[model samples]
Target: MLSALLHVTLPLALCVLLTRCRLFDAVAVDLSYDHYAEQRVEHLPAFLAMPCNCLVNLLYIITGVYWLLRGTDNAEPEQGRYLRQVFAFMSIFYAPVQWTRLAVLQRAPAVLDQWVTLPIFAWVLVWIGFIERGAAGWRVWHAAVLELLSVLSYGLALLHERGFEVALGCHVLLAVYKGVRVQLTHGDARTLRNFMFAVLSCCGFVVLKLLDLPLARYRIFQRFTGHFWSKVCDVTQIHFSICFLTNMTSRTKKTR
Candidate 1:
């Protein structure tokens, strides 16, 4: 548990510290209020500037906590717990970072927001690794090495204006590929349904965020906003991921 907490937080702390040092000053991020479709309520405090945006993040905390408690109770192998909980912890840790980004609209939080996303998606890959290779065949160092590469992938952001986007694209692609591959290897009809839902949610998560502004032309999006729905998609993906991974990580359960 302590190791999982460290794995989730240490990177955050390092990113925050580096951001404080202006390491991502050159990074391209929308640091403007106009970046989001949700209008800031002038009467509210900065933290509540965009009520929907700030409040939407609560779903992450809720999803993360809910899934963290779902360990393999009497399962034969127990190693999947670390990967599952690490990913859960990452989700819980993510809420505040994203909320801070919308609230303060500062560089550190903005950079941290984008930086943390790399590992969050990477953890999915890690979880899939455990699903493919059971406990005994997987080692702690294997997770460490992959996650270390994920953490380092954030360096791509400093290279070009669109570097972060490029890195994020790769992470999303690899996760999707691994997910599809695992379905063929270990998934049955039930897992396939869960995987499809997860992929749809993942697509919504990306597309809605990208269309945040354009979607504002619609009345439904003016208040709720595309960003808000994107978060809904985010939490939805997490939920399905938990369901899918929980099943796959179970050693006693038979897969087709």
Candidate 2:
């Protein structure tokens, strides 16, 4: 019953809220105009970059919920330990980022902020943990490669107007890595579903933007699609994580 409620009813409720509310509509208009005006006057692309951050934040919230609920046990011992360590690191890192964004950027960071910092942190930490645990051979060369790419990406974001693209590219790679890792490690149906939803949600936003759909005018569709996709990503992640953890716990008990 709990599972059914989480799987079915929760999604339905999210769909209704996203489609019916006027909140995101107002925010979109405010942010779009703010960005356009800033670009026109200050020649600053930072304002334009804000919306993408918001989108990423939304994705993070969805994914984070999954991590919290998924219970960690379904993953292989190495993967599970890595995930926990990474998540703990991220939760710590998030405090500073959130503070800086609020104090300096003067904008409230979105829930998806975790996506920007958390996942990468998780990956790096996981790799480190893997080496520490002696579960996998550590390759300094591989670490160097990843670190170099990460630095290049960060530098690009700081140096040019195209920095947003560089950042987005890095995010795309991160998402791909997570998807591949999850699949290779677990091969769970729920994990696949989560990946699909994440990809679809990101793609859907890009499509909407490209189509130039007047979301400001079409309040209903705007709210519904916005909220629905957001929640879909959220629910999918939670479902996958919980299922993964449950599987891991069961496996461990059996082994013991």
Best by TM-score: 1
- Cα lDDT computed for each candidate against the true fold: 0.85, 0.41
Candidates in order, TM-scores: namely 0.95, 0.46
Tens digits of lDDT, candidate 2, 127-150: 433323333444445544654454
True lDDT of residue 74, candidate 1: 59
- Minimum summed lDDT over a 10-residue window in model 2 is located at 29-38
